[model samples]
Target: MFGDLMGMMGKLKETQAKVEETKKRLDTVLIDEKSNDGLLKITLTANREIKSIEVDDSLLEDKEQLEDYLILTLNKAIEKATNVHESEIAAVAKDGMPNIPGMDMFK
Candidate 1:
């Protein structure tokens, strides 16, 4: 029983190490998704917070169209950011063992 407990503790430590590494790597990754016409662009961190935005000078003249495109571009960038962040996190999560019963806590 003691040996098994020691092994589980070791696995927990390994899992903690992996989680820290993932967090560090995620902080440095930048995902930039833009619109087709270059009218709008969004920059996001790996955690999917909007870091910056850019709008073209031409779009400033058209109120209605610019409003529509702004919404579209913002939505698209957000969607892409979510997908990219999820995939990156999933890659890390999948490599580690599932947090289920009878399974290794870290792989």
Candidate 2:
């Protein structure tokens, strides 16, 4: 039992390291989102750090419209990023998990 426990602990540590590495890698993963009319384009890392924002001259003329576009586009990008981040981490964790009974986390 103790041996099994030790093994599980070691596996947990390894999985944690892998998750960390994946998160760092995600920092380089770029997600691009654009407004429905293509007047606003934004790029950001999978870590949700904004990298660039491109706006059309027409959008620049209206502050409220620009804010709305930014909010909508950023939310879409953030949702995509969150999905990727969660899936990657879950995959790494599920792969490294010690097969303990009743712990089908991925299911």
Candidate 3:
């Protein structure tokens, strides 16, 4: 029983290390999204940090329209980043975790 406990502990430690590594990698992931018929573009990291935004000069004439497009584009970029982050975390969990009952919850 003690040996089994030690083995499980070791596996948990290994899994923790993998999760940390995946988090670090996620920081470097970049996702791009566009909206308003491609008039607006946003780039963000998988960690949800906005890197850059591009907008067509034609939208500058209408402040209200520009604001709406900005909000929509930002939301789309954030959604994409979130999906990528979740998938990466799931992959790390699937690869590093042991086949214990209830472990599928992580996936």
What are the Cα lDDT values of the candidates?
Answer: 0.74, 0.91, 0.88
User: Compared with the true structure, what per-residue lDDT tens digits does model 3 show for residues 16-105?
Assistant: 899899889888999989995999988999989999999999999999999999988898889889999989888887777776777687
- Residue 86 displacement (Å), model 2: 1.1
| Candidate 1 residue-wise lDDT, 29-79, digit = tens | 777877897778888777677888888988889999888886887788778
Which residue ranges in model 2 land beyond 4 Å of their true spot?
none
The prediction achieving the highest TM-score against the true structure is 2
Off by over 4 Å in 1: 98-107
In model 3, where do residues sit more than 4 Å from their true spots? none
Winning candidate number (lDDT): 2
What RMSD value applies to candidate 1? Answer: 3.4
With candidate 3 superimposed using the best TM-score fit, by how many Å does residue 25's alpha carbon deviate from the native?
1.2
Q: Residues 45-85, candidate 2: write the lDDT tens digits.
A: 88888999999999989999999999999999999888888
For model 1, state the Cα shift of residue 52 in Å. Answer: 1.8
lDDT score at residue 81, model 2, on the 0-100 scale: 83
